[model samples]
Target: MAQSSRRSSISGPSQHNALVSQNQVVLYNASSKGLTVNYIHPACHTVEEPDASTCPYCHRPLDEYNHSAPQAPTSDHRAPNYFHLLAIHNESTSRPLTPPHLEDEARPPLSSETMAEGYFDAFFREESKLGMGANGSVFLCQHVLDGNLLGRFAVKKIAVGSSHKYLVRILKEVRLLETLRHPNIITYHHSWLEPCRFSTFGPSVPTLFILMQWAEGGSLDDFIAQRRGISHGDTYQNSASPESEEAHMTKAQRIAAFKARTGAGASGTSRPANLKAVHLLSTDEIVSLLWDITSGLAFLHNRSILHLDLKPGNVLLTWDPNVLIPRGMLSDFGAARDMLHQGSRTGVTGTLEYTSPEIIMPDPMTGALRQTDSKSDIWSLGIILHKLIFFHTPWRNGNDDFSLLEQEVIAYPGFIPDPSITSACSRRGLPTELLTLLQSLLDRAPGRRPSCEKILLAIEEHK
Candidate 1:
């Protein structure tokens, strides 16, 4: 008697068994839309159609497919598209079925709780307006959570419909600030994207708020004016002879006499004696201030950054009187750029008076204005130094003649006062080494100018 062949039972409605050999059973699934079934082989397991009806090696029924046709010896070699099928097979149960949706309620939605605590409240609170600029308004905000005085921060709420270039420039400034960390450089504390709250705007536009350490003394330009007034008063009081009010009287008389005398002259030149009353800085103080500024610039340049706008307004003094020298902190990194190895070129950047000649003059060979690089920054620094010492910019009195201005700058290279003046008309005469350093820094050719490190070294050696 022949041995009875045992057939394997299907576990689900989608699952079915097909005969592989006399004793072997293969599981498979029938296509729900059609009578055709997909064959799943048990050994050398794969989903495919069998050829002919008998197994290729075993010479038995191709039980992989659930069909009345005779088993094929070999399986049809074709790739299967699993995506089309709605069911997946379970290896353990040998069944085809759908699984549960585990992701539906796995996580909770984020509400006001998940957000930064007190952020919304602090952002919405009424802030004391501090300053306004082209981009946005600054507000002195109170930290809601800690109640800590978040020292004078500028809440720069950007304007909507702003040009892409302006936005890019603003972002670059922020990025530059982010990488920069120095004592002299302004600190960029934090910045964040917030919804615009202006009454005129629709729904909400994207606005960026930058938190920075505010300069208490305002711009260097204002500071210089204040200093000038104080210095003038000090000069008047000190020069007043104690022995006789007559000395002061004579000084005033000589000035009036000189003005009367000069009334007949067409030329604007005044007598040296009349100009003697001008209270200029002592040589020592001027040199010291120059030294301080150069040191700040050196630090910035060593870090591969250029202060494109180095002027009186940008150099800030910390508010401490005992600190004899102006402990200057370089502000406004907005125009700064990396220039360790780049060549100098001129472009329409920086203040006109402080802008370098290389920027103003186009290179004949390239026919392009040199991009203001590190050397261009040095030129600006030289101008700033001249202003700090002389209390006047070199280009202040220049007529609208571009060629004449260029010639004057090229000829002088640096500040050039009359050689015959006996009095210390400017800040006390700077030391020889300091003066030499300034001259070198203010060279006509960018290549001729000394590196910021060299300048720092010279200052230290002189000290």
Candidate 2:
């Protein structure tokens, strides 16, 4: 539950959902009915955009429709005329990958045959909300027959009312997940389309279901919050709830006690059983966790996959199962891309705060803006490192959005970790090597950043 709260929310401050990945690209027309569109990149899955006609695969316009497009789909069961135009739009734009969503030609694409409603009704039960995205909701699922012994899974469901592109992106995500196999990445179990059997509203929307490996430990942010005894909402700040002072004080006292027990103020004290943050984790262990991420990234890059978004929330944490230890794994391929098909784009697609300087900047030759490459992902990884060690972001310009934009533009390789981290690390003579490595990783120029393999090696040497 703690992990569920700290999404790198793409939506506005007032909005949140369990399923949506980020804010949907809402398109409104006062003259005509408002049309809202949100899609996983049709081919690359790099970025989610507003209601633009750009083909996510080629990053161009969907100029024409295919002759044999599926009829407009209706949310109502087996209905007509409801989604005809959406079908045309999706079918026309959806581009198949080279191996067509497979690692190699030996494997075939997963069939689009959706699972029937009875399967879910009989097997799985909703335990709680996991997370939300622009177009869907994710739930913690429990197996009815197996109890908790078999472990749990997260199931994400997208409604049929979403734009045709939205559904197609999900289809592509399923295919992509099927192709990917890595220990540091979220494991995809099963995905299928199912009719909503429970909703009382107008024609039941066809829902896309993706069952994923449940990282019971939650996201990286959540793990940090839990280890630090920090509240999920209003983090790295005064997170006291408006409801009661006693509970807040109790939490504060617990944190203080935890810090005291862990001896975070001392130099290289032994790790406490409950402590899991900067104080407890060894540089070796931390790098090992980082190795998990880098290995996962290497796997993606090897397959020509680019995980455009690499924030704390996107990197999930699961229990070791053998023990309570937290192990890192990458999740949420909604913003992932297939580099084999689409080249970098000039448009910015990720969160502004974590975005690299080069992503929003223009190329010298093309003069086109927002072109990002693998190095962009490295920049994001640098920010996550800052947060992990410093307990805050390096770009602390101000609270409002404008300041954030300013920080993204001017923030550079020279910026160090927060002053708090500096003080602590200075006392312990720690984070010295790690921060120095991060400087290279977070370089403003993409070409200056290190590759995934080198990062892993660097972490290994530091250990």
Candidate 3:
């Protein structure tokens, strides 16, 4: 996998450093520096290149960002490969995005219409708050189409202050979400900006409203926390004949029951630190979700993008009444970047626990951390897999000291689960092959780590 450069040459503010929001409208202006002025980026900048040469947004000359041959899977769906599944799902479910010039003909001017009649009342009806953060809040909303409630969507409302750099970062995220289509990745719906006050007495700022597909099952971390309650002698064990009680229940019902006991809800909550142990997910479910996550990662890699942050919190779960397990979809791309044009790191990015050693470990000679690549993401995936099977990370500093954690991770020697976890894996029928894969994913040498494609191949072979 060769590295890809950032398509957009303009540097923007990142959500990590500035207030930001997520929404679904494309408005690009060549002169406007702030997001308040409707600077829409051309969708072509994020995805595979099109035939036209001029920039659709700025009417400036265009240059090819990616010259490499496309890495899309074969059209033959008859093959039993995991890539085929992703290809089929993407083709069937993802809508063809309209080009910038043809945007008016493709869809109604909903952006203007919503702005005329208050965004929430005219377009979507707000339901409940899903999650809130320093810069923005995500809400569960019902899409009001033709005077009837359609489907639920997660709308992220971000307060975009007067910062050109942050505006650019938000644009990068929106452009990526708008064009990147995959079943295991959250779908972008619509986005537009409106001025709203962050507080009652405070002045209003440009709040970006990003509409996206709602994952009903919350996040993977939420799922794990509820499962931990079950392991801690919660309702499942306390019930009279728990096995018989749940024999006819659906996956949603089982999870709901667990949530009721654990005080979990649609918006995820952190697991209590007191809960020292957690119930391990079944091997089948783990493998299935692994396939979902790896498939999404593989698609991004194919596009020459690196998901620098791949952790449980960033993986949302979508539940179906008929399906036995919830599907994992990758979310939160604030830390992701185009691997092809990546530059030297100013500081380490991503969650400390899941960040690869190559990114966090200092050089022996220069005493500076090395640049990361696709393999750095594989190490994060390995940590996720470890938490899935053992209910905890393989290595920890047990404190908030970054240096200590970095040192511990550098010396980790690739973890093999203890007897208790191995015994659980045995009872759950986890294949030894998977354990081998997990260890290899955490290999200290990034070059030795398996690519997402290789991981999917291993899964297909085992299946």
Candidate 4:
């Protein structure tokens, strides 16, 4: 690649801008800074690097998947691990996500030839809204077979524009979700794409519909609140107490308790509180929850998958329809990606508070984003564990999550749990092995972190 003899290196907003493509990647000059913008990163200075440079972010080569590695698994899992599902989901009334978890007709025919009505509309009927978020809304829908209500499921609807970038995200999520069959992970049943036009007409916007198992028990955040005791308004608490008092509480009782405690009649279902619930969990409850999540992560990382967002919100709880016991199941595949896939490693890809230090900081030598791998997931899990034990993450010592994360990212290569928090877990009978494992998971050096399988096996021994 060669550049013209005439070049400008303006520092601020200038009038000139030009697109530059090099080594199969496109770069552009900013009008103000005369900086090179990366193909994915816009308005950045010298963000595009040599195509041959390995990504400090994902730890993969700049080039996309180029090797004859194992082919990524498809939606149809050839070798299903029913035994894992049998352990938890089957114990109660759980069936395969089809048995594990639709259709609408008589609608004005879609004009877009590419609309996926043939697959999605033919089988599923969207009902009431179950949940909504910044990116999408989830609906409780019925799977219809020959006009019969086959079962109930949660369908996530994400609005998208017509673009390969958006399509890749949907495909990546579905493909990744499809391969995961562990009971601890939410079951992905089906997916479809449709045009975004019904009444309002404009450019043909696309949409994605992902059908997944409904976690009737809600998010782990709610579970933590229920197990811990939440209240409305200003609050103060450090640990989950009332373990003995809450021992006999069923999901209904706990939800009721949370409502009563949080003055839900005055407001609504409990919102996230900085304070912990009054009741702390017993050693057994804590162990079971930890084991469940650890097993789920093990299953994921074993397949070279990275759950970039492993926050409490994504860890859902679902009761066995038959047994009535609560089980922690991982959900939300939006930020997940295959490490072995074809592509350069990703940039920092998670909530800042839960993001690993390595991902936040840049490499001193390369002056680029530091390489982050599956070990980053381990760091996130360690933070989740801390939140479970201490009832909150010390992302920052001063004001808020952002500040806490800022403090840590700025102080990369150095982070340790507050000794008091670890001490509390110890008081609650967190075994020495498990505690060490936790520390290792959060090790500042990514290489020092244990594998998901090792964490699983070690914790199993403690259990």
Candidate 5:
């Protein structure tokens, strides 16, 4: 039997079957007005095929057409005007066909303007609160299209306030996100400005809503906490409501809690006695996670952008059914800065624990605080690597004490884990190359630390 290779299947015999059965080429122009049957248009035939006969309808002779040319069908036509050469095959031969509507998959992503306030509420249904931060909250949402569940997404709602500076900052982050396109980086979908609903900044203020790809496995911070059997408290709770736990607390209570969490009022750094790592990652798993992070950091550094905050909390994870461990992707660019256009401001930037020594302590030569650069990120990466291996940072004091942390960074030597931690690493079969890379990255002098490119090479070697 003969069939139109790229068109609808022929179920029963028709008047065109005579030509089709002979394995001859045929073109049918399907239009809104009517069907031009048994006509081979000049535009439809190619030089590779045998010469086609003249079109009986218009009396126009067939001309050689480059079928591979990048030309789309005219909009007035209901379907394709040209068809491929008919081929003869057995009637019993069966093959699955793709539906025509599936072509819509190639359409470009929806624009932010098209997804303004009402459009978002109509398509996305909020499932649960993923996490809450000081200025923003993320929610897990189910995206629906024509009554069909498409997939899950993460919607980040940040309070913009009435200040122009805050609004510009949010817009800047959106622009930064739009320019980024890497597998290890979080994918940005859509963003829009809407009236603030949950903000304490009054109803007149606007909120910036950013739609991002959902990371099913959660953040690395939560992942590590879970593996170590550590409770993340309300801030990291997946089931916490949109209203934060501290929302109802009095101003004084909030301040007191913040002080305790930051180790501000505490005498010195101390780990909870009950803290223990129950499920530890193997050497291969550690290398794989670090490789993803290093690749992402390299991509950013190559473009002259710096991820000021490189803590585990900013690194999201997604699991693949085929892979054993979750894949890490860099997210949350709120603190990211473009060194090209922006001037460096020296203040405490990013989380206290993961911050670089140069950003914390004054320069020994000039007694002046230095601005953060790419090397600062390397120091933070070293901290993350140490955490992945030992399930805790190298610091003896707790993370929140900035004054003690400054002292710790100033007196920091090379990688020196506790005896118990050393034993744990030995049992995990940690590689010598990784330890070498870690030591180099943790160099107290910013000039001494390796670049992201060097770190990537070392990670590749470990792999």
Candidate 6:
């Protein structure tokens, strides 16, 4: 008797239905290698880039289909070659390659059981208060399980109920940081939600706890102050003209100031304040730091992420005291968000001093502040670099109030480094290359700012 054949069918949504469908069939040939047969719907044409829908012709969805069909038995046929049959089988039913572990799935959601574990209690215990901000309080916490006393971390505990928007912001920050892994960016260890009640608030609210690497030296603001020294002599010479003072500083003085301020004192060639500081930063170190930051920005931008709050405080030192160069990491993603598909209307979400002009200025026609974009981050970075080189913000002395400050930012978009500082550095004048980079980044129009990659390349080529 002739051998019988087995057939299988797959089912999926019809094209007429709101959801479309597709299907594929595999046939096992008794005398030869297997084959794949696709039965696509006529109406549902497969475009190069197809949206989520079923095949219009067959009314079957792509995912729903019978993957296998038995071969017909043939009495007179010789058996198929084993190797060819295996190859054909493999080709017909190959599975999609799995993505990298990091991209596998949304981080497993934090469970209430996990939250109730000692993780929260231990993190909050003996939390030496570090600082406080609009969002929450920062504390220096010890790692409970590791028993690494010196391995301190910063814990940011944000109380819920302020606003759902703020809660969403915190969640977004956690999500972004959890996936990012870079030396120049702060690391996110873990997070948990704790239920608590407050007397003033009346009802209890969920408090979110975020753990991060602790910056021992505190903010760059404090670091700069320490480098300049507390005495009047260490202060920028107010009496001398900016140009004249820069000219008078010796190489030793410049180097000492740079070392003292940046904490780049590894060479051990200590000289008195008379000589200019030998900017220990080789052309490479400066380039490296710039590259590091831009790379970080590029990563964020590629993922449609925006670090709305970009400032010196958000850029932290990585605690490398041995190296004779300024090494830092970026932190504080509390205000970051996805900008790929949506306009960011979150009003004025960054530091006042470093915010872009577009954010500060309201559109006259719409009577609303223009939304912030990746260019807003570039503008903020430009201001940050300006402060590093000049030791002051462009809008610092010009205004006493927010309104006046916004006016100043609009009027003078470029920051001219103090000539005094430039003149004082004997090894070289103010980093003109960095200044130019900053100017371009600070452009009022978002469209004009260079992409992060371009900025990184410019910094690398800076003389």
Candidate 3, poorest ten consecutive residues by summed lDDT: 15-24
lDDT (CA) for every model shown?
0.51, 0.57, 0.63, 0.58, 0.62, 0.55
The sequence of per-residue lDDT tens digits that candidate 5 reaches over residues 359-442 is: 877668987667667998999999899878767776655554567766876677857444654665677787666777888888
Angstrom error of the Cα, residue 318, model 6: value is 1.0
Q: Which candidate do you rate higher for TM-score, 2 or 5?
A: 5
Clashes of each: 23, 22, 19, 28, 2, 31
Best-matching candidate per lDDT? 3
**Model 6 TM-score (2 dp):** 0.58
- Residues 359-415, candidate 3: write the lDDT tens digits: 877788999778788998899999888878766675534325667777877777886
lDDT of 6: 0.55
Estimate the lDDT of model 1.
0.51
> How good is model 4 by TM-score?
0.61
Each model's RMSD to truth, in Å?
27.6, 18.7, 16.3, 22.4, 16.0, 19.0
Better of 1 and 2 by TM-score: 2
Backbone clash tally for model 2?
Answer: 22
Off by over 4 Å in 4: 1-111, 118-122, 196-205, 231-277, 321-325, 397-404, 409-423, 426-433
Tens digits of lDDT, candidate 6, 1-463: 2111212223233211111112222334444443334343343343442532333334344334423322212110111222133233333332111111233233453334323323344324546888778788887876432232223568887885434455555776776786676666776655655654535767756567776667665665555444434332354422122222333468778666656744555785654564443223344544555565676778788778888888766766654536555556678887786786556475777776677878877899988878777898898888766555545566533223667666767786465445654464334544567656777887767898899988877875662
> What TM-score does each of the candidates earn?
0.56, 0.62, 0.65, 0.61, 0.64, 0.58
In angstroms, give how far residue 445 of model 1 lies from its true place.
Answer: 2.2
Q: lDDT tens string, model 4, 1-463?
A: 3321111111123322121122112122233222233332321213354432343223333323323223222221111322122122222322112211112223333235435534455556878887677668888887553354445678887775545455555666776777667778988755555655434656545677677778778877776666555542223222223442343468788777767755677457556566453566555666677788888888887787888888787888876545444788888877787777736554667777677887777788987876457888888898787677656664433224456546755574443545764776688776556557667877887898888777777767656
